[model samples]
Target: MPSEESEVVVVGAGQAGVAMSEHLGAHGIPHVVLERHRIAERWRSERWDSLVANGPAWHDRFPGLEFPDTAPDAFASKEEVADYFVAYAEKIDAPIRCGVEVTSVRRHTHRPGFRVETSDGTIDARFVVAATGPFQRPVIPPVVPDGAVPVQIHSSGYRNPEQLPEGAVLVVGAGSSGVQIADELCRSGRRVFLSVGPHDRPPREYRGRDFCWWLGVLGLWDLETPPQGAEHVTIAVSGARGGHTVDFRALAADGIELVGMTRSYEDGVLRFAPDLAANIALGDGKYLALLRAADAYVERNGLAFPEEPEAHVLGPDPDCVTDPRLELDLAAAGVTSIVWATGFATDYSWLEVDAFGENGRPDQRRGVSREPGVYFLGLPWLSRRGSSFIWGVWHDARYVADHITIQRGYLAHGTTDRPGLTPASGNN
Candidate 1:
């Protein structure tokens, strides 16, 4: 309200949004980043007490900075990462309006600006960057029966393993989130049980170098099969879901018991289907698809690949999914804790746009929306494999910011032809 016109309005001051904030600052762009909570508050508040980032500290840092060598290979705890982000904000002086919740964004029919509404008030801006990460919405399956227990929580809500109930804890979803939590629990002398589902494979070192380097080379973050669509079916890479990660191996090392995928849960009991590998198969297929895609891309781009991968392609968790049935007596086990790291859902209700196809995602290329001046960043594989992750944000941010800068420069210099200047996105 104070200024009827502004340069840009960015939503969500997390990793993605914050990266944009830094780039905008470097160019002296007068923009505001609207965040519901303090910068990186989610990392500080939501992660498990003992949880460290799965990736090492070297690759996990945000743009414009690096973690001290003292930081562990696993990176510091969630709290440390949060603190680093907070410190980053201060150094960059990103214009962040913390505690301001964004409600909606609608276009101004008369101009290039968008009318953005927030908890405090509304503003109009010429451009918008949705740095909001894709996992804003948590995916909770609806297979649970009524009154299963009083303490059901998603991985997002879990801050410490001590919060879970005592006895044999049954963790659902064998993805990285679930597996990591299970590893933590078992390592801490807790008898943990994990409901094995479809999962990703593990890699030794990606290519001839570290695994992170390989992810960059393969364009994992850059590759995305629309969550749904023809792209979902045809372009969907098998390796998308289950790329190399520490899952079953970690479980084996930690001595955690793996359970079959639960088909249904009722009356404090979880039931498994006859086919056990059903879930595991899905996970494997996605991972394989991704690996194949990466291989094809390397071949297509004429990029040389290293010799064969040293790691073996893991098949399934110890508990085979081919069996007919099994059950988990949560009540009897006195199991208290459950971590659902299965995956995420996109809740874009606040974004009113017709561009979103049936898949509920705005059809765009490289964050350039079908709608003018509306851009997206930090989406998983938005341009390439690392696009949304810490190591990748800077690359994407520079492209978008440079494009914006060029556009501004062009307009100022009185260019006769007005081309839609977008950031140059090279998946290098």
Candidate 2:
């Protein structure tokens, strides 16, 4: 096999990988970006046709890159978002090799670096950055029993209502993906049954402004908390609803049946946790907690922000859980399809190192892995709440670039280290 070499190797050509390459380029470092598919392939292949960005384009700009001036505030469609990523890569002239899938990554024993094997060939690098993204693998519940219904697709495979068969659809896991898809299905004249789970329900527009903007203003985006904790649960917000809270009660009122967390799928009958009402109440409570925190901050700072109307709540239904209808029969309910929006699992199986801990995660300070010369990027809460988003990835990306430069003894060139870009061996 042909061999290649670079000072740094970045896997994936999505926004995160692009950002890492940009930073490396700015530092005059020789690096190559490898992508298994086209740039921003998820946006092009995985998302629904009608899906738009959860926030305005302004919230999605990367470091040293901004959304087109023409569509600054508009919600970018999936295609538009993909185009933006491609354009950014081209505009920066990033050294990206598309259609190159990295098959394995392992320590280079002969030297201080990594040996990366890819579909195209092999490459050795002094440093390897895994920019494969937070959503690497679709997570279907293990309890979803054998011999499931005829049509079962992860949200990653779902495109639009036309693709689904006639009759009701059971959307498992009501996170952002589940709620959004369920809402769309319901609106498109399909009877939708949504299985509720532990999720956060934040209003799209808390006051007159978007929820993201409020988070940015409150310095929540700058939060550098670690990833593991009790409060760690998959977030549930609606992008299709213009970043609005996906009110379960409202969804229930819209003729969408809301069931508790999925328990089992045996013999064509699906069991639920029988805690639908309680789970919804907890989510609503979290929303209120967020609202109260923001309110307190505004009052303490004496900011002159105008008040919006009181929040609209679709109060709970006590009978939802008590009813024996929590058990769903796939054939009898007329459910023809099941869309699992059950979140993603981070799989580093291809990495030929014991970098993972007992928790199945790499031991790293920020993006710097314990195994020197390896780094992680585009992970949620890696450095901040925005660490996984396009706008926030710069924080971790810059840090990784600086660390690589320092390891290469080029930090003195003043090329990689800016005031805040110094390599952080500790949590900020």
Candidate 3:
């Protein structure tokens, strides 16, 4: 088939796909967005009620919809963010084909068209955008001590305190989700033990500036304006999670017991790493320094303090405590539940496409891949800073949408496959 007879297909209508679809609609580009599930279903299904966006209500919002107005420093609940996404989908109509699960994509060497086979039907498209963001997969390390006393559950499967096991529960991993789950479990009066690992942290506010303000000034959240020669570095910096990035310190102040990293969960006791505190401190200090720098920048810029930043330091505390311990040995620690707030993994198995690399991740530079017109958006390190942020996908999508438009224009002028639209691997 010729490219002129095809449409553009976008896969995965999560945050990334939604942004791509909105841009395509804005550009009058004819594209259909295929989502395996309804919009915002992941957040609703995978997160608990107390789970909130890691960033403040402002930065957490996706394009086209503002979070429901709440306290200035409040965290937007998962439901609120989900509702916002739902509204965003409707606002754009976005040409979304709900329940369409794409099975495979094969590029044509004869033309710049892809035979995209989906559950609904096969549609040939001149281009395909794999906007499936990260967190599509969950990683559960099987380091649990054999015959451990707790019920193990991945973060994705946890919904409420009741779902957690009895006694002092161990919440591993200190990412946003980890700490949040710890706080929730503790609030529900469960004796909770937290295993803090290396994760980013940032203050909600710094030096009288809203968290986003410093991000804008230091060019953190200024994702639209890409800096020169800083592609990889910028992504790395943006992805850094600081203590200020989360409220673990506050949770600690609230009396949540913190422990060193679990070296191994054998003998019923989660053996502590001798340098676990050092590891936690290193990860924590980097983020703290970032928060301080943002605050310093606010002062240097001479901007009127927008909000009074809280600069109080947490009091020195014990390095580790084995409290909430059930058994004197490991089994009696009474800790029966283990919630792995570790994180998610990316799954691309359903993509029967021929455009993946050896790592199974779509082999793409930013959005453009060697696989002809196959593109992927909202991937970390895809391009420039925050390529996966709510504000970042526009740049990547525009680049891809422009490419598709060029292909369409060529096809409009009676050009079939000038130079023969060969796949990267030269398959038809």
Candidate 4:
């Protein structure tokens, strides 16, 4: 338990390591952070006690904090967004530490930068950052085999609907945690289903705004990706009841049962993927291309915002996408729990950094990496498209704290020709 030194270490006290320790203590640098559990520990113990905060509470917070008493368009709860990131890490006195854990990082064999190892021990950092945020490890898609569901789990181990198991649940993954845990297990009377993949439904409000204010007045949350054919979709909007419009034909007129896209569970049957009416016409064509791009950005900025017309309806098509049941059987349809809202992978296998890529992710750009001091806070689009939200991880942690204050002014001038520290652009 010795080694500890830090010109920055970070690794994850959530809300991207307390927004990278409040922009590395507003650039005076010297960081620490750590956290293997506490401070928004996955919104206080991995979500689902009727979670909330799919935005709203004034654009999902952190422009130096708010959401205390909440209500800027509400939606906060998930224990008020984990007590507003533990009151924005105690209003930015953020050095953090919280139980510590990291486990490995690599690079500094003898010296120039990161070592990190942790569960409370070796630190040695010239810079590390990780900010472990993309909801680490929960994917669950073995396609439901092991004991096939007497009560499977993951929706980060769900929580409410009286903790399942009275019969008929299923869920699987329609994103936004499987249509809000199959609309809270079909409003708790159970018998749900869900599944339906390729998501993106939008509208939790339209002309009277808040589809994240038309994705921030239609710049579309600074889009870094996911528009062109919605690359593997998934954002099925819903801040739960008070916030609405996930629809699936109004959750199949409130009876739930959606299905499609599970594709394999074998003998006790399951199958699925007849693409439930092409996943409800690909979420009604990305919810009519985000209401015709918010009606052409309110007619090219003439903006007075009024038209709702029930946000372009689309209704109808439901008996599991008009008789599209490809298969199910689980004890002749009395299922008995499953959940799996299938999403969340990002362990970084304790990050031994060749800066990752071949899709093991972290091939950074905006949170700079290609190795030099190795940053990377939060994930999702990583630079734009609300980089993992919470005011886009405080503007990508103040652009990795101004690129770690220009790589600590070229490592205090012994310069290795760092220039603007390259790695080119964003969204890697």
Report the error of model 3 at residue 181, Å: 0.4
lDDT digits (tens) for residues 1-428 of candidate 2:
78877778899898889989888998988889999999999999988888888777877777566677426656777888898899899988999999999999998654456788999888877778999988889988777665576688899999999998898999988777888899999999998988887777877777566778878887877888843552356667755644566677778778888898888877889988877877787788878877877788778989787775467444646455446256888899898899999878787887887577789887887798888888999998887888888788866899999888787774234535575432222111
Q: Count clashing residue pairs per candidate.
A: 25, 1, 20, 3
Model 4 scores a C-alpha lDDT of 0.80
Superposed by TM-score, candidate 2 places the C-alpha of residue 163 at a distance from the truth, in angstroms, of 1.0
Which pairs in model 4 have colliding backbones?
Answer: 168-336, 247-250, 261-273
Worst 10 residues of 3 by lDDT: 234-243
Identify the leading candidate in terms of TM-score: 2
Please, what's the RMSD in Å of model 2? Answer: 5.3
Q: How well does candidate 1 match the true structure in TM-score terms?
A: 0.78
lDDT score at residue 428, model 1, on the 0-100 scale: 9
lDDT at position 134, candidate 4:
80
Model 4 is weakest, by summed lDDT over 10 consecutive residues, at 419-428
Model 1 poorest 10 in a row by lDDT: 232-241
- Cα lDDT of model 4 by residue, 346-427, tens digit: 8888989899889887888887889888888878787778888888878888888898888677666633366543221110
lDDT (tens digit, per residue) of candidate 1 on 106-171: 877644567888888878777788878777778778877435765667888876667776656767
Q: Against the unseen true structure, what C-alpha lDDT does each candidate score?
A: 0.66, 0.80, 0.67, 0.80
lDDT of 2 at 36: 91
Point out where model 2 deviates above 4 Å: 226-232, 312-324, 410-428
